[model samples]
Structures are given as C-alpha cells and as structure tokens.
Target chain A: MRFRIRFAQQVVGFFILAALATLVVVLILMGLNQRWFDRGYSFYSRFQSADGLTPGMPIHLRGFEIGKVTSVDLNSNNRVNVVLQIYSEYYDKIKPNSVLELEQGTFGIGGGLNLLPGKNLLPPMEPDSFLPSTDTLLGKNLLAQGLVDQPANNDQMSAILAEVQTTLSGVNLLLNNVNSAIDGTSNNQLTGLLQGVNATLRSLDSVLTESAHGLVPNLSAITANLAKLSAQLQDPKGLIPKLLDPKGSLATILNDNNQLYNEVQSILDQVNQTLVQVRGLTQYLNQSTPQITGVIEDTRTTLKKADDVMTGLANNPLLKGGIPEKKPQNATFHDLRDEDF
Target chain B: MTERKPNLFERVGATTFDLFHNTFYAFGFFWNVLGETFRFRSRSRVSTQVLVMQILFTGVNALFIITLIAVSLGTVIIFYGNQITTLVSTNFVYTILITVITRELGPLLTAFIVMARSGVAIATEISSMVVTHEIEAYLAVGINPISYLVVPRFLGVTLSMVALNLYFNLSGLAASYLVAQFFHPIPANEYFGQLMTQLTPTAVASSVVKSLAFGFVISMVSTLNGFRAQQSTTEIPIIVIRAVGQGFALLIVVNILITLVFPR
Candidate 1:
C-alpha cells in the first residue's frame, strides 16, 4: 500500500515535469524572437474607438512590423489611449510631426494605426510621447446621402417638361382660334362673289364663242370667194394672164405706145432730174425751212397790214397811231407763279 | 481523573486540533518519503534500481499514453487557433500556442492525469499497509516508516512529473506540426520561427514554476491521503477520490497565479 502511494506521487511528478519542460522550451523560443532584452522607448496614440485593440497588436512601418501595442486604456473622456513599445533601433525613423491615423477600411478589414512620417527634419520623438490624430472627415451621413439624393435633378427635368407642356398648350390655343375662324365663314357671300365672277367670265366666253363660231364661217366664205377670184385670176383667160400675154391689152399698149412710151420716158427723165433737185431742195428746206417760211409769212402779213393801213387812212380821217406799240407776248406770264402757269 | 462530559464546542475544538496535528504529520511523512528515496541511493544499488524502476513505471512509463494524448490535444488547439487567426500575422501563432499550453493546459492536464492514475494507487496501498500493520512493524525496527515507505514515491512522482511535462510539450508540438501540415500546410520556416518567437523565457519560467507547484501539490495531497488511510478497504477509494479532487482544484489556483505573474 505504501509502495502504491509512492507510485502515485511519481506519476503526478512525471506530468508536472513534462509540463515544465514544454513551458521552458516555448518561452525560450518566444523570448529569442522578441529580443526580450532589447531596450526601447514607448510612444502614444489616442483614438476615439479602439475596437478589439488589445495589448500586443504589432506596430508596422511600411508593412514591416517593428513594435507592438503594449497597453490599451480608456481615459475619463472616453478616448482610447494606446501605448506602443517601439524598438530603439527605429528611434530615428519616427518624426516629431508624424501623423497618427486610426484608419477604418471596408468590411471584414480590421482597423489599424497608420503613421505618416512628416517631411520636417525634427528630432526623434521622445519616449511616452503623444501624437495627435487627424479627425475622420467622411462622416456617416455623407455616403448615405450621396447614395439616395437624386430628387433635385428630377425636379429640374420636370421643369423642362412643364415648359414643353405650356408651349404645346399655346400652339393648341392658336390652332383652336384658326379652326373657329374657318368654321364661322358664310357660304352665301362666297357663293355670290363666285357667281358674279362666273357670270362675267361666261359673258366674255359667249362673246368669244360667238366670234369664234361666226368668224370661222365668214372667214371660210371669204376664203372661198377669194379662192374663186384667185382661180379666175389664175385661169388662162385671167386679167394677169392677159396682161402677161404678148397679144393682150398690155402687150398692145406697149407695142402701140412707143411715142407715149418715149414721152413717158422723157417725163421719167424730167421726173428723175426734178426728183434730184427736189431731194436737194428738201435737204435745204430741212435745214432752213422754218426761217424761210417765217420770212414769207412776215412779208405777206406786212403787205396786208400796209394795204389795210392805207385803206383805213384813205377811208377814215383818224390818224394812224405811230408804229403799233411794242408789247411782250409773255407779259401776263411774267407775273404768274410757275405752279399756276 | 474523574469522568468528565466535555462540551460539544470543546470536543469540536479538540477534534480540530487533532486534525491539524495529523495534517502536519502527514506533510512531514510525505517529505521523509522523498528524503528516504534519495538516501536509498547510497544504501544499495539494487534497491536503488528497484526503486527507480518502480518510479519509472509509476511516474514516467505510466504517463506515456497520457503524454501522447496531451501532445495531440495541444497540437489540435494550436491548429485550430492558427486557423482562426490566419488573418492575424503568423508571428502571433506561436505566442498564442505557448501561452495556452504552458499557462493553462500544461499544468491542468498534467495534474489531472496524475491524480486519476496515481491517487487511487496511493490510497489503496496505504490502506492495505494499515490493514496489515506494516507501519507498526517498520516503527518497531527503528527505521522511519515514512522515509522508507513514502519518500521515494514523493521524489519519484515530482521528478517524473517534470520530465513527463517536457515530453508532453515536445510530443505535442511535433504532433501539432504533423496535424497542421495535414490540415493546412504551414510553411516550416514561418511555423518554426513563429513558434520560437512566441515561446519566451518568461513564459518558460512561469510554466516551470507552475509545474513544480503542481508536482508538490499532487505529491502532498496523494501521499497525505495515503497516510490517513484506515483499515477499512472502503477508505482507500474515499481517500483516492479526495486526493484526485483536491489535486485538480489546486492545479486551477496555481494556473491562475502563473497567469497573473506572467501574461502573454
């Protein structure tokens, strides 16, 4: 029985030893990786919400994890303050003006702190330093509003529709007025005017028809008679034929009228000479006929007047006035206005 | 002396004092057992070998199956934890595994397994010893009964527990790798590096401290229960039951302390 108890103790001890050894191995490995003995300064970041951000979240720079979140706590003001344990090796990498941002990305994407290194050549930030984070600008309402806000454009489109509606309505009113005016016309006045013009045209058509109907018969009759006359003239015994015939009257006249022909020839010669002199005289008269006519008419008038005056002097005792007073023919016209004249 | 009727309170107090004294004696008896096991080394090599073999059977060999079971269990935990945190960087994989194994599973599983396997043995053995009057025979021979009977078991159990814990973790890590590769092939470089990085000296120290505490508790509880074993055969089962129960409870407390002292 005592041996049995001894065995039990040994058994328990065995398990304990195994557990200890494993623990030792695991710890040694972890310590080596973490470089547990390395000295480093701490940094601080303040966030509004540190969702699920526990101690030991790694701090990365350019995707390279260089440190870890050592502690997390909320202040009295409800702001989450995180303490980061950065390795001393990267002390110079962090700038004083660097910005710490708590960037929350799309769904299923965990949020993290993004450290943006500033351009200023500031000294390395001291340990336990606090860097302020920029506030999140894309508020919750912005995206939601942007998604659903299209009513304004719809309203503008409706306004154009209304304008088109008014324009169509105005055109409809003008068309209605034109339709009413055409519908209101009387057939009587239109018929009367048409009748009068039709009657006048019918009368003129009657006259033209009468002229055409009668003129054709008359012209046909005249043309028939003229044709008969022309047939007679064209007959072998016609006057033209007889005149042209050598033994006809014209031929006798020509054969028996040599003396007459010579007389006519002499007359023609005189006529030709006279025609030449007449042509010259006509040209001279064309040049000065008005002056010569005026001189002849004046001499006739002066001789008639002198005879009248001697007769008057011989018949009457009244002394003749000295040469008729000279008077202007346009004496009355001189005072008359051009318009009146 | 006159026959006196003691008051109930006085009787109760007396019983309590008696319990306290017995408890102290039980602790001493358990220590003497460990001392005697060491002393047996100088006395005779054959006896020492026998004792060692006994210790090996009870402490090391008996734990083989449990060690294998625990290793696979640890590996399964690691595999699942990795699957869950794949989105998380691989660096955290080892830390999570080490923390869970050492801080919690290692001490707890080891303590419980030993309590069940060895507690009954101790209780029954000591009860039989009482039934046979071997304790008195040892006392009559001028040999310290505790040193000869209990000390070796204490030393054996404690030492074997530490060794077994190491074996369990090693085997568990190996099994974790095999299983992980079968399920999801984690690159050897990344897995090994991550596993190394997460297992820190602080964690190792804490685990060792916890394992030692568990060993001491299990040894003390199981052996003390054995010392108190009476002649009744039923008392053996009763004591074994209590030893196992107390060992588990104590393991939990020690684990919590370890966590508070050294967190991942």
Candidate 2:
C-alpha cells in the first residue's frame, strides 16, 4: 500500500524514459557509425592474391577510412576479386585512374587497402567497375605517369631520409676502403666493417621509428633490434632452423607468403634495382611500407658478412672439392643474404 | 481403492506425467499473463499501482548497485582490451566491448539482479497472500488471482528488465571510456565511434529479446511457485527458495536458447 505513491510512478517513468532515450541514442549512433542510411557506391578491384585482404578491411584515403572491402571472391581469371563499398560522400574522390593497393602491416601487423585517387580531376568511375591494383602493370603505369595520388612526399621527409642515406653512404664508402684496410690488419678491418653496417641499420631504423612525424630520431633502438636479429642468425644448435623461428625473419616472411611471397619478392627486387639506379622506391612503398623497413635492416645486417665472403674468397685457393670444411660450415654469406635481406 | 504404495514403475510414470502436466500449466500461465498485458487499458486500475510498485522495487531501487557493477566490469574490459590492441586493431578492442558488455552480459546480469530481488519477493508475497486467504478473497469477489496478482508483476518485471538492460549498456560504455583515459587518452569520438560501427541491429535485437525472455521466465516462475503454496505458513520460504532457483535456471536456459536460436 505504501508503494502506491505518484512520485514512485514518476520515478519509474523517468527511469524507463532514460533507458529508452539511451536505446534511441545508441541506435542512432550505430546508424551514423555504420553509415546505415548513407548511399553506398560499389566497385571491385583484382589482386594477384587475397593475402592480407579480408572483407570489411577499411579503404583508407589519406589515413581516413572512407569505405570497406564488401566482399572477396575468386574470379574466373584465378585472381582475387575484391569488391569495395565506398561511402557516397567519398565517392567523389574515386575518380578515373584511381587504383587500390593492399597495404600489408609492418611485421605482419596493422594495415588496410588504401584508395589512391586518380591525380586527374575526372569523374568518379561508374559503380560495379574494376579498379586496378598497383601490383598490376596498368596500376604501375598510372603511378609512373603520376595519375594516382601517392603519399604527399613533402620536402621534410625527403630531407630527413637524405641525411640517413648520406650517413649510410658514408658507411658504404668506409666499407669500400676495406680492401686497403684489409692490407693493414685482419681483425681491425672486420670490426670496422661490422660497425659501419650496424650504424647504417641504426640510422634507417631511427627514420622509420619516427615515420609519423617524418623526423629521424637519434639512432638508439637499433642495437636492440640488431642484437635480436643477430642472436637468431648466430644461434649454434642449428643453422637455418633458429633463423626460421617465430622470432626470426622467416616466420615474418612466411606470414606474408600465403599468396604474397611473389608480390613481396618482386617488390623487393624492384626496390633493390631502384636503389641502385635512382634511389627511389616511393611507388612500391605503398604495398608494404613496414615490411620494406624490416627488409632494409635485414639487408644491411647481411651486408656486414659480405666482407667476410670477400676476404675468404680473396685468399683461398681452389681445390678439387673447393675448400676444406670450415668451423661453422653450416652458413655462407650468399646463402644467408639470399634467404633474409 | 488400493491402499498399498504404488510400485516403482507406477511412481516413475506418475512423476513423468506430473512433469508434463506442470509444463502445460506453465505455458497457460504465460499466455494468460501476456494476454492481460496486451489488454492493459481494459484492466482494473488498482493493478497499475502494483505495476508501478513492482518497477519501483525491481528497477528504481536497484540502480545504484547496477551502476557500481556495470562500471567496474566495463573498466576491467577496457583495461585488458587495450593490452591486446597491438594484435588486433583499436577498432577491434571497442568491438569486443560492444559484444561483451551490451550483447552478452548486460541482459543476463540485469535479469539476475531482478530475479534475486523481485522474483523472490513476488513468490514470498503471493505465498503469504495464499496462506492468509487473500487469493480466495479476490476469487470470491469475481476477480481472477492470475490476472489480479500475477499479470501486473509479469508486465512490471518484463518492462523493468528491458529498461535495466539499456541502463547497463549505457553506463558500462560510458564508464569504459572514462577509465580508458588513464591508460592512454583516447579521443571520445574514436572510442565511441568504433563501438557504434561495430554494434549491429541484430545484436541490439538479440539483447532485447534475451531480456524479454529472461523477464518472462523469472516472473512466471516466481508467481507459479507462489501459487504452488499449500495451506501451511512454513511453505512460504520453501516456495521462495524454489522460485529463486527456478528463476536462475530458467534465465540461463532461456539465454542459451536465445543465443543459439539467434546467431548474432
């Protein structure tokens, strides 16, 4: 009988109403968050493989998620046909010549497919049409022709990388002088060569560590990474097994290998060729930005042993069976470098 | 008539028959309560007071404890969720929050609260009404005890369950966002933004459906046990205990069934 107060009823009403309000708010927020009411534009892109690509992976433009991978299908051509659902608002950015690049995460980590809009101010491509991938020839042509918007390479990041490149080149120059240093002393030249290689890795690692700011830090974390990578390389029990473990490069390499080994290898070869020819790898950088960073460090690490190969081959004579079994005949400089860097 | 005790086979058959008979009666009870609820405008006004009082006792009174539990649980999720953010995306952490707090735990935990407080109370109160002949008084006055006693409570508990579940979701998400600030300052838009995107209409409906089922099960079990009371005062605690236990068992079963039936 005491529970029959009008105020109690009012309190109940307020409680229920508040909850109803929250429910309404949640639904509204969900609608907005999911673009429930927005007009969606559909488009498809073909990739050589579906590695690192999944339905609902975001389609980013300048770091903002503008859409998602709506579906992944294997088409008649035996290629991965990824359908994209771009929001109507961002549809204007999907002009002609726009291409998609599946960005693999650093260290097999966080990445999404980026929408590099056409550099031309042409109209948006029709819905349900194909968008080429940068992995394809047409995509490379569009990129080389400056038709697709690559990352805005401002002078700041360029200048920072140039400083690192200069330091690394100095290390290379010092290594080039190793032939003369080898004429002087054996141990001193080897130690200096190793130091030069490490310093090169440290500088590159520092640049990527501050990738967001595009400013290179004082190279410090390189020693730890080098130590970790070297421990994987120098483990005594087995030659290849330890280097292929989860802690080593092979595990990370295999994670991208389901359908990605070819793409990654081609890109690495392209980067190596580009480095020698023009010092430019900005085009392939969009594919697996972080992966390139890891490979570069690994390449520099293996480059340290290149001098060892040079020294041994320079002095040793050819025999019927090449040479007697060395102490750690398990690994060679070419074998290690070919597998990792 | 036979005076000897029934054999084992006869006893087993009788118990099995009783089980089915009781199940049939329970369904009838549920349909009647649902019918009375739909016919609310035509019902007696006194039951409105009962409904209001039921909500006051069940929903309004339980707000503080609900907030305390919701906040702590939400904070714990965000704390642990961030630790694994590297393996999964930031958006993924928020999505897990929506799935765990809103979809799974919200309805179930709130129903447990209501059942503990109001379900036990409903059974005890109704058993006392039966013992004191108040139920018979209502029947003598041409009023149906099920309609007069159980229907209002059924509606009250059902409505309160829906409302309380919503409260749990809101307070839990809000508290997680606040607590998440301590680990790393997450932009409010990004935190809530990902949660909103991850939340689906299917999930929301699933949660609401679970709440309704739990409320229906708890209220019906409590009132059914109340009416099971015999002509002794000692039966009140027995019926009350039975009601709480049945409410718990039914809520869990209903939750499982709903989750399985509606794969969200």
Candidate 3:
C-alpha cells in the first residue's frame, strides 16, 4: 500500500509540474503575442489637449496598430506632450511631416492616435524626434460640430459654474414671482384688467345673444325674399326681358317710326295747349293782384288778434299763476319789496 | 467548583488575543514550510513519500470535479459571450473571456474547490491524529511533526491549487470554443489567434500570481485550524469546519488584495 501511494504521488507530482510548465509557456506566448521582444523606437508628439489619450493606447496607421502610446504629459505651456513607441518594423512608415491624429471612437467608446502621413517623401523620422499633431483641426472641428466636448480648464469651468449660478438665481426669482402670483399676494393690474374684460365679455355675450335671436331670422327672411325676387327677375319670362325683346309692346313702339313720330307730335300739341291755359290764368291773376294783397293783409290782422287772445288765455291765473311772472328784461331796475330791502 | 463568567472586556481581550496568536502561528508555519521547500538536500525519504502522498490526495484526486466545473463554466460563458458578438467584434469577445477566466474566475474557483475538498480533509486528518496522541508519539520518536506532516501538506496543497487553476483555465477555454462552434462556427486557428492577440502577459502573470497566493493561504489556514484542535475527539469535526470556513475567507481577501496590487 505504501509503494502504491508513493507511485501515485509521483504521478501526481509529475502532472503538477506539467501544469506549471504549461502555465509558464502560456505566459511566454502572451509576452510574444504582445511584441515584448520587439525593438521599438520612440517618438514624441505635442497636442493642445490629451482628452482621450492614454498610455498603452494603440497608434494606428490606416487600420493597423503599428505602435502604442508610451506616456502623456502636460508641459509647462499646458500643452500635452505624448511619447509614442513604434515597432522597428513599421518605422519606415513614419515621416517627419506625418500628423498624429488623436481620434475618439464613435459614441465615445474607445479612442486612439492615428498617424496620417504627409505628402513630402522624407526619410523616416529619427527616434525621439517631435511630430506634428492634428489637435488644432480636430479640436476645432469636433467643438464646432459638437462631436466632442471642449476640454474644460479650471478657469473655463469656473466661468461656466458662475453662469450656471446666475441662471439658477434668475430661475429662482421667476419661481418666486410665480408663487406670489399663485398665492394672490401680488395684485397684478393685468389680472384685474382681465377680470373687468371678462365681465364686459359676459355683457357682450348677452347683447349678441339678443341680437342674434331678434335679427338673424329677419335678416335671413329678407335675404330669402331678395333671393326670390332675384330669381323672378332672372326668369326667362320676366318683365325687363319682355320689355327689351324685339317682339314686345315697348320694343314695337320703339321699332315703329311713324307711331313714335305721331306720339311725340301729340305730346308737343298737349304741352302747347297747357302753356296757352297757363298764360290765360296769369292774365287773370294780374287783374286781381290788388284784391289779393288786401285779402292777405286782412288775414294777417285776424291772425295777430287770435295770437293775443291765445296769449291772454295762457297768462290767466287759473291756468299758470299769471304766467309765472315774466322775468325782467331791464339790465338793473327791479321792484324793491320790504322783505328784499 | 463553580465557573465564573467572563466580563465583556475580558471576552473581547480573549478574542483579540486569539486572533493575533492564530495569525502569528499561521505565518510562522507558512515560513517554515517555505524554508523546507527550499531545503532540497536535507529532504528525507519519509518526507518525500509524504509529499508524494499529499500530491496524490490533493491534486490528482481533485481533477475530476475541477474539470467538470471548469467545462460547465466555460460553456455558460461562451453561450452568453457569443450573443454579444453582433454588438462587439470577435476580438473584443475574446478579451472578455480572457478577463473573466484568466483574470478573475479561474484562480478563485480552483481555490474554492481545494478548500472544500482537500482543506476539510487535511484538518480532519490532522485533528484526529492529534486526538489519538499520534502527535505525541511522533514527538516521542524525536520527529518534528511540522516538517514531516505540515510541510508536505503545505507544499502539496499549494502546488495542487496552482496546477488545478491552470487546468481549469485550459479546459474552460477549450470548452468555450466547442460551445461557440455551435453558434459562430469559426475556424479553430482564427479563434485561437484572436484569443492569443487579446491575451496579455500582465493578465497571465496576475492570474498565476493570484493562484500562488491563494494556494499558500488555503494551505496555511487549513493547517493552522487543524493544529488548533485539542485532545478531545469532538474537536476534529469543529476543526475541519473552521478550516474550510477560514480557508475560504482568507482566499477571497488575498485574491482581492493581489488584484488591487496588480490590476490588469
């Protein structure tokens, strides 16, 4: 039993060692996969902002990750100075004029630095040399299009906070005003005016109701009668059309030349006879002119006496207490009574 | 004679003292085992036999359950991992698997299995030996029980944990691929290539380091609990329960500390 246990132990120990060996091999494989053995050359880039840039973030050429970010530092100028380590194999792809673009993933999921090559065919950039950044273009474009937020420095953030505080104060004031209005503590003139207008509107409503009840049907009936009359006038057998028709009586009278001449001659004869009678009557009036004037004078005298009698009757005490004692017409004179003195 | 009840302060002081005392004892035992592990030339035939026997008991015996749980865990991970393939790239999926299996679950689950199985067994065996006066017999024979028994078990449990964690990772990844074939059906080379690309040395090192630390903790805690047993046979079951519980707690705390210190 002891020997069997010993054999089993040896077998288990062998398996344990094997498992550990496999683990070490896996670690080595991972190191190799990460290019830990590869010789890389470092380059530097300066950006205005290192917003999404981080160490170990891959640097891509086209779509391939040819390098990685080694470090990011804020220089004394408040600019981001980034160090990039590119594999020696891809060193030829770097040019002195190559632009390093710090791009973020869509919806801000991931971000990376991309090397956009320039037109000049210069030799490979020296290790540790500085490369230009696309920060100016990218930052401005992203800020303008609202694709990315602006990096808020201490001063800008403070300014934004101040503005927010001011807005909050204004909102607080507005809320206070609204609360006062709701509680009826502030007697708003507009509210009183609105109430008055509401009362007027109620009166106007009653007036309009009366007018509608009284006038609407009558107006409708009048319009209906007008419409009937218009319909009758528009009928083919109407009087106006009948009168204007060539075969109608008025048209016949207009169309017959001899009859129209005879009618005009008879109308002229009647006017001449009437003028003769008017001349006779004028002669008669000239002969009786004196008598007519005397009769007009007599009639005026009789009218004056009748007016006096009517005035005396109106001034009788029984009628109006001596016509209420006519007001004096004199400028200064008045009868002085003992009580007035 | 009538026993007097301990006051609150006395009870607190006793608890505190026991905590510190047990912590120091476990640490001393760990140090001694570490020293023995390095003393290759001084190793005796009996110690070698004991070490081999421990390896057989802790590691070889636990493989079946470890493999079973690992494969099942892998299948479940891949089943859900494939669902997100449409939203994220397959490379990202591989990264998720590596982070979950290698970085977190692999070492932790292996430690749990070892603590549940071998940890309880070690405590019960040692406590029983103590109760039967076998420990006294070893001392009478001028044998250092710690170097003979505890050191071998320590080395055995720690080595077993590391090996089982490795096996678990391997079997999990393999099983995940098999399950993923039913959903995605990609070539094996392509799948493995993507996985390799996503795997990092830091991640692998973190996993191995975690496994090593957890193994050491589980073994030390279990052995320490075993030694706490008294002459009464009733203490054996209590010691075993304590060993399992304390070993689990120490494993989690140590795992968290290592992850924090070596974040991927």
Candidate 4:
C-alpha cells in the first residue's frame, strides 16, 4: 500500500513538472510570435484599390518588408484603408512623401501592391497618420484592350501570311517560266513558227545575193565609161576642153574673121614678093648668058672640079646614113639687102 | 543470504550493453509493426487503423497550430527583416523568409517544438509503463513491446513532422503577403509571385523529409531511453534528459546528412 501511494505521488509530480515545462515553452513562443516589447510606430495608408492584398501581407519600403498588414477594410468614403503594424525602429524610415502603388505585373500570376517610401527626407510620417495614396493604374486599359483587339491582330497576321504565300507562289511560277525559256523549248506551237523564221531568212539571203550580182556590173560599166571620158578629155580637139579653154585661136578665128583674114592676106603678100624676086633673078641670068659663056668656059674647069666633088659626095651615101631619104628641092634664098636686121 | 546485484557502475554497464543489444530487436519489432500496418502479404484493418490514428494524432493534430504560428511568424519576421533588409531589396522580405524560413527555421522550430511537446510525453508514458512493469508484462504475454508502443509513436511523429513542415511552409508564405498589406496601403505585386516562383517543389520536399527524419529520431531516442529505464523513480529524469539530448544530436546529424544529400 505504501509503495503504491508513493508511485501515485510521483506520477502527480511528473505531471506537474511536465505542465510547467510546457507552459514555459508556450509562453516563450507566444512572446516571440508577438513583438511584444519592440520599438516601432504605426501608420495608415488609404488606397482606392488594394488589388489582391490580404491582412497578413508584408508592408515593403522600396522592396523590403518594413512592417505587416494588420488590417484591410473599406473606409466610409469607399477608399481602402490599410492599417500597418510597423516596428517603432522603422518609423524614421517612412518618409512623409511616400507613395503607395497597386502595380500590375506583366509576367506574374497575380498583380501586386507596393508602398514606395518616398525619396523626400523632409519629415517622417507621424504615428497613426494617414498617407495619401497615389500611383494607381486607374486609366490604363491594356488588359481590356488586348481582349477587344484580339481578332483584328490575328487577322492582320493572317493577311500578312497570305500575302507571303502568294508572293512565294508567284516566285515559283516565275522560276518555272524562266526554266522553260532557258531550255529553249515548250509544248506550245513554236516548231511551226521556227520553220517560218528559217524560210524568211533563206529568202533574205537570196535577195541579198541577187542585189550584189546586179550592182557588180553597174559599178564596172560606170568605171569604164568614166575612164573613156577621161581619155577623150585628154585630146586637144575634144569638145570638153574646147568648151572649157579660154578663147584660143579656133575661138578667136570663129569670133573675129576679119582679123584672121588680114593675118592670111599678109602671109600671101609676103609669098608673092618672094615669087617676084625669084623671076627677076632668072631674067638677069639670061641677059648675062653670052658674056657669061666665055667666063663659063674658064669657070668650067672649076665647076667640073666642083661637080666632081658633089658627085663624090653623092656617091658616099653611107657617110650620111642617118640623113633623111629626100631633101627639100624648094629651098629659096633672099637678097641680103632685102633681109631685115 | 542473497547475491548482491552488481555495483552501480556494473549495473550501469550491464544496462548499457542490454540497450545496445535490444536496439536492433526494437527496430525489428517496429519493422514488423510497419509490415503489419501495411499488411504486405496479409492485410489487417485493425492494425492499419491504429497506425492511421497514430499518424493523425502525431502529425495532423500536432500541426494544427503550425499554420497560425507560421503565418504570424512571417508577419513579424517580415516586419523586422524588412527593416533590416529593406536597404538591400524592397522585396527582400520574401527572400529572407525563403532563405531563413524554408532552409532553417521551418524545420528547426518544428523539431524543437516536437521535442518539447511530444518528446516529453513519450518519455514519461514509456517510463511509467517501465516502472509499472507493463513492458515485462507484455514480454511474459508473448507480445512484442516495441510493436505495441514504440512503433505507433515513431510512425505517428514521423508522419506528423512531415505534414507539419509542409503546413508551416505554405502558411508562412501566405501569411507574409497578408501581413504586408496592413503596413502599406499597397503591397508589392510581385512579392509573393516572386516568392512562389523562387521556392521549388524540391525544396519543400526536402524540408518534409528532414522533418520526418527528425520525428523518427526524437520518438526513437525517447522511447528507447524509456524502455531501458530500471524500475526506479530516479531513473525517470535521467532518461528524460538523455532523450532530449540524444534527440537534439540526432536532429543535428540528420540535418547535416540532408545538407550533404541536397545542397543549398
């Protein structure tokens, strides 16, 4: 009985000790949980829309959580009022010019809210003071516009794609046409056209040949005629030179017959005078014939000698071989007194 | 007239040797209970229910306050961590929570809580059973003592620790955001978004695994010490002290192992 009583007392003591230990730990945890004796002040921020904010959300200055969101509620004027449970040590950090923003992020699941501790270090926000809210994305409607303009955007893209496809098809057709042209054949009726072209070229060649044959003779005749004309012009009697020369004797005789007749008369008069002189000479020789007979006999011997010399000279024709076959027998001599100086 | 039991040192040495010998046996017994819980080849609804109940008690019930505590902790930490780290990054409130909370505080705080809350309860329960010879009674009755008592507690705490860790992490993350809203009219929109993106599933999973292992260590050490207690009132305090000390040591070692397994 005594041992059992002692064991029972011990059990009770153990329970008490366990309870005390549990109490101490719980109290410590509770104290740690609440910043029971930490230094800090509080402040209020009024926002139009809290976005997706909740009570336990962190209150960040710049990007750091300076305090906790104690409560979020709608005020009398329908503005969102957030009560901050900030540490007193961080009170000096919140400037009076701080702005709160409900920024919507582009690449995140949900948009977030921000408290921008302002840059102005003029004065700190007083405890429990309400800061005016600014920097809301109130008028921006990109999210709504994205939905409204969806179809037009898609249509634009599709139109561009179709244009690209059409252009590509045109390019392909152009390439095919070029390939046919370069290879120089097509199923189209080009064979007949080629034959016609060949025939035309043959006709052109024949015409050129005929034209050349005809021109060759004409050119030769023209050249020969020109040569003949040149030879005729070289003659003094030719009509061309007579027509071109300046008033020669033929033109002078034709134009002035009286002067030409006077010139002929003067020539005939001189010839008549020469004839009379010759006759006079002959008569004088007859008158002196008898007296000259005796002198002739005496001179006969000298004449005979002269005749002999002439006969000898006439006999040696070889000595004068280059002389003309016949000399002029009509040679006339005039009186020396009658000869003019 | 009687053979005196060995001196205190001899007895202590003998008890230590017995503990070493019985440890593997205890493990084997726990393994069998696990087998029975799952009913590998033969299904047993009763054993499974008991195992489930143990899990619910140790894991679910114990972690009920985790969310509340974690959320509040996030708020307070952000409030303070923001003040210090604001100069570094305005959004660093989330980062601080992620780096400090997920990596260390979430697991460590849970472990410490469990050690004080559950560890003491286990040690006392087992010690009372020892003083009363209930364990001896089970041996005589041809029932494994470890399966009856130790396995349930071990499995319970292990499951609970993991569950509680997840609860704490999720709650801390959510609460940090909620708490931030009150301090500022508009909170940073990308704050929590960035937080979720930064936290990987693997990180959360590792914390769970760490907590599970911690549960096993605390439960096992406390139960083992209780089982080894002589039928003396003075032995209770000693066992309790050893339980807490060994629990902490095991937690540290396990944490190191986890660190080595999965680097920061």
Which RMSD does model 3 reach against the true structure? Answer: 30.5
lDDT of 4 by residue, B210-244 (tens): 88788878887778778778888788988898888
Per-residue lDDT tens digits of candidate 3, residues B39-134?
733878888777777878788888889999889988888888777654444355686788888889989998998889888888888888888889
Tell me the tens digit of each residue's lDDT in model 4 across A15-107: 334434543543444344345466557777777776766775655555555667788999898878888777765677767556555544333
> Native contacts retained per candidate?
0.46, 0.71, 0.58, 0.00
Model 1 lDDT tens row, A1-341? 65545575464445555556555665666666786877677888777787756676666566455677788899998888888888777778677665555534233233355555555667878888875554423222332334211123222346679899999999998777655545555345445565677889999999999889978998899999999998998798777877799887777777874877789889999989999999999899899989989999999999999999777876665665644666767546564365563
The per-residue C-alpha lDDT of model 1 at residue A187 equals: 48
TM of each candidate vs. truth: 0.51, 0.65, 0.63, 0.39
Restricted to chain B, the TM-score per model reads 0.84, 0.96, 0.94, 0.78
A156: Cα error in model 2, Å: 24
TM-score of chain A of each: 0.32, 0.43, 0.39, 0.32
Fill in the DockQ of model 4.
0.01
Candidate 4 local Cα displacement, residue A184, angstroms: 97
Tell me each candidate's RMSD, in Å, in order: 45.2, 37.3, 30.5, 39.3
By TM-score, the better pick of 1 and 3 is 3
TM-score of 3: 0.63
Q: Positional deviation of B250 in candidate 3, in angstroms? A: 1.0
* C-alpha positional error of residue B133 in candidate 4 after TM-score superposition, expressed in Å: 2.1
DockQ values, each candidate:
0.17, 0.34, 0.28, 0.01
- Kindly indicate the candidate among 2 and 3 with the higher DockQ: 2
The residue pairs that clash in candidate 2, if any, are none
Error of 2 at B68 (Å): 0.9
Model 2, residue B17: displacement in angstroms? 0.6
Find the candidate with the highest lDDT and give its number.
2
